[model samples]
Target: MTYIKERRRILVVEDDIDIADLVTIYLHNQNYITHVAYNLEEATKLLEQRRPDLILCDIMLPDGTGTDWIRALRKSADLPVIFLSSRQETEDIVQGLELGDDYITKPFDPDIMVARVKKRLRPAPSTSENMVATGENVWRDGWLDLHFDRFEVRVNGKEISLPAKELQLLFLMASRPGHVFSTDYLFERIWGLDNWSDVRTVMVHLHHLRRKIENTSSTHRYIITVRGIGYKFQAR
Candidate 1:
């Protein structure tokens, strides 16, 4: 049997032909399949025909605002939406974020734009059924050992206890090794979207988790902060 990876689809909605084409070219360079829509009308029609994995939308659309479109899009789909707008006002940025996952102001670096998209589309921090069945549940490094099945954590060869939430956070990061998980993603996955605890809760839990797993006196770190991004388990 042959296996082929499906390319992730991205919909770009921008009225500027130059910007739209440039964004499309950059997405294509990364091997992601992209569809361009010049306005909200075309974007809506394209969405009806084919739902893309993610969307890069402009705020100032010919038909309507990206924020309004996102409000409607949220009714049907929970996929990631990134706002690519020239609206530089604080209120505009905040509003865009409230309605979308990310907001990139105009004259944005193409590399950063692609990076944000990649981060948003990363594999969710969940162990798959196959992994569970295969018993790929143990993670061991220099001084840290985790038995996810039993929720047992050993540091420096001694068993230690962790709060339920902390244990869960550790397990998720360890499972993926080096995958970056944004605060929003981690909070949603672990605490759940309905949980009242904000993203800061994730930071607090990770801080405690690091203290527990990492050698307090040493300079080595197991959980690395990606700065402006989130955290990743650095197994070495």
Candidate 2:
């Protein structure tokens, strides 16, 4: 058994030696402790040894596809899994989105891939609960501050424009700052599993929220990275 110390450990599961090597190297460069697996056996072995914070998997492997691994993992673990695939079929994409954390098509931009991974791993801090809803009123920065009954997210002493989903997600997160919630959790809360809310959908919504709130703000970045964990709403 490997004695693990760091919290932000990542697993890159790919059968292609070259691709796996490249991913492992890049993740290492980002200062994220990483482990590589070439097939189901190796991947399972690594999982048994130490659970990683997140997993990046290629859908197709020599022995099986990433879907196979995800199905198996879903039976026992909720560890985030991002699919890396050569095929860009919608069905495949949807299936993966439904099954995993995120997906990247073949010949992907390493920077984008890294950014996605980092964003998904971002952490939210402790915050009090007084949620703002849509069409109500909330202020952030020097803006309209248009939000209803959700949580108190003051942008420069005002509220900002918020969509329904964003409001719900923020409300949930703000209710408990520094509480990490996975994309799956977000989906379950916002869209519900029965409704087909998947990881990719959650990512898209988070992307929008981050752009609207965090990226534009000069101070008080509300969401911080948690490495391998999920997001937590920042307080102060």
Per-residue error (Å), model 2, residue 228: 34
Clashing pairs in 1: none
Q: In candidate 2, residue 125 scores what lDDT?
A: 27
Q: Looking at model 1, report the run of 10 residues with the lowest lDDT sum.
A: 127-136
Instruction: Encode model 2's per-residue lDDT on 64-181: one tens digit a residue.
Output: 8889879988998887788999989999999999999898999888888888888776442223332223233232334323232444455544546678888778665653344456
- lDDT of candidate 2 vs native? 0.68
Q: How close is candidate 1 to the true structure, as a TM-score?
A: 0.51
lDDT of 1 at 52: 79
TM-score of each: 0.51, 0.49
Q: What is the C-alpha lDDT of each candidate?
A: 0.80, 0.68
What tens digits encode model 1's per-residue C-alpha lDDT throughout 5-60?
A: 34467888899978986897687667565777778987888787656789999999
How much does candidate 2 score in TM-score? 0.49
lDDT minimum window of 10 residues, candidate 2: 124-133
